[model samples]
Target chain A: MNEYTFPIVFGVFIGVVTRLYLLKTDYRQYPTYLHGKIIHIALGFIAAGLGTIAVPAIMEKEFAAITFLALAASQFRDVRNMERNTLNELDQYELVPRGKPYIEGIAIVFEGRNYLVIFASFVSTLAYLVWNIWAGVIASIIGLLVARKFMSGSRLKDIVDIEYVEPHFEGAGLYVDNIYIMNIGLPARQKEILRYGMGFILKPKNFNARSTIANLGQRQAILHDISTALGVYRDSGTPALVPLAKRDLDDGRVGIFILPQEKDIEKAKTIIGNVPTLENAIRMPTKSEANKKGRKLR
Target chain B: MTHEKLILAVITTNSNKIAGGAPIFTCDTREEMESVATNLEAILDGIAHSLSDELLIIVKH
Candidate 1:
């Protein structure tokens, strides 16, 4: 109803949206239930709005400090608890092809990052124009930084440091995989644990990183003897089966990863851009414990 | 501990087991180390995905 209420509510709303936006935009490489985080942030806004009104009436000078502390404390408690909740179980292993025939796409219009910038500024000020837009601007930065911090960067880091398997056999059948070409890398400080093959089970269309493991225990005719009996057969002029170039991320830039199909080994050699081997791969020196400024792999 | 440190410690230990030797990453070159790292990470991920309970147990440190 009052002037303070408008800005306070506006600020809180902005803060929540910004938090959600970063989580959505930057978290392409990793997984954290985005839906739940949106809910968490929206509730944070409602809490901020209510606190803005209630705090000023009770304690004017210290209202900002009190509200901020309360938010930090309460948020830490709830999120920490949520993080601690151990995994209960997993669904049955359902098989689905890439982009597993789902309804087109989910649609949500973005109001852009500018609105988020303004809204976050307002919440920190707590319904007051006591400081100029300078304060609001600072608050906006702080809000965005804090929100990203809340998310962490572990997932982003790990995704960048990818692994490739050269067509190895395993037990869970044959799984052709590649990382989902979403936005890559960490957004500031968001940490995530990304599961390639397993997550594929959850997301039908999610193109996962290729696997080197397969479950084909059935060993065919002795390939080694074939290689030995002939005593190193000359390279057959016939072309091997080629892997389809899948452009899932839409950046026009195809992704990189290791594959497990040895049959296509020859084709893959041509299809893959830069397949690093033991000879060419950059063997980064392992960081010593004393070195704090280490180059992060992920 | 740092993220890489935590991950590397487990990976090195596992690679050591696989190689039946010391923690040399079972790799002779940079390329091999990278490949080995990738497989090791996948192994860790597969473990996590298939056995979250076990991952939690192993990651207790």
Candidate 2:
């Protein structure tokens, strides 16, 4: 009945729609269940309500309401912590565990999306109050496009060249390209490995990418992603059958060894290329002060 | 002190090569050595690493 009623409802609706668009349960299978989605949607709704009311609060000279954003920041931070704890707990039992860095990256994304929701709601509401519904719709669309741009980070393909290599046995040592993977003594076990195992070498595109791909957590994330997508051919008791990534010290290339049940080289390569380059694992060595001074560190 | 990697057992055709530390299983031939190492690897849930043609050690990683 008030001037703010339609605008508030419109803002909240747009915010919730943006949240739903972002909360996709992709191949990562996070928030896969109905219950998990419910929890996030509920939190998103709260964020939208908070954002929509702020414009009216400001117009009424109730500047005190702006302080509620600080509270929302803390609330979203808790969502990050909750995600981290849950993923960490579940990781232990996973066939190919998502490493700490990958889990942290996912948690950060969950928290960040809520802030995007708030931004979308606030902008849309402000437009509605200032002009009309058409302005509000246009503002919401722009907000959504900005949200989409911020959501996606670089993929593995952007930084490295992935080439398939057949794993070979040099004496008893298993090697992917030139990088030594591990040793297998039993002839039967070695036979089984040769039959099932596949290898790929990741060549870093730049000096900055070398350190990033060499990160143990990043390497683990690669293994986890590929294994989840292609189905790992391994069991608990078989330690020798596990997938591994080893770095070549001479050239900064990484050797990845995996045992996938479905031996489709092209499909596996596509999966590896699609893996998100973790935020925590990114190291910008070229951007450092010493490097910027023209000293060739690499 | 606890070790991250421990050699749980050793199976070798040449018994003179290794003596102390981990429990050693001496085999008469290469076939005997391979079978013994394989069994130990499965039983102990450790990886069997070959030192040479005649020697294998099952180590927990």
Q: Best-fitting candidate, measured by DockQ?
A: 2
Per-candidate alpha-carbon RMSD to the true structure: 19.6, 1.4
| Model 2 segments more than 4 A misplaced | A295-298
Cα interface RMSD of each candidate: 13.2, 0.8
- Tens-digit lDDT track of model 1 for A1-298: 8656655655665556564555463212112367655654665555445434443544456544555545544554554344233111111111111111100000011112222333354445542455654565566667777655543322211212222332211221123254341221111101121221111111111112111111010000111111222222122221011111222233222222221223333333332212111111112333435332555322
- Per-prediction DockQ comes to 0.02, 0.77
**Candidate 2, B-chain TM:** 0.92
Chain B TM-score of every predicted model: 0.36, 0.92
- Give all TM-scores, in the order shown: 0.33, 0.96
The DockQ value obtained for model 2 is 0.77
Q: Judge the docking of candidate 1 as incorrect, acceptable, medium or high.
A: incorrect
Q: What fraction of correct interface contacts does each candidate retain?
A: 0.00, 0.67
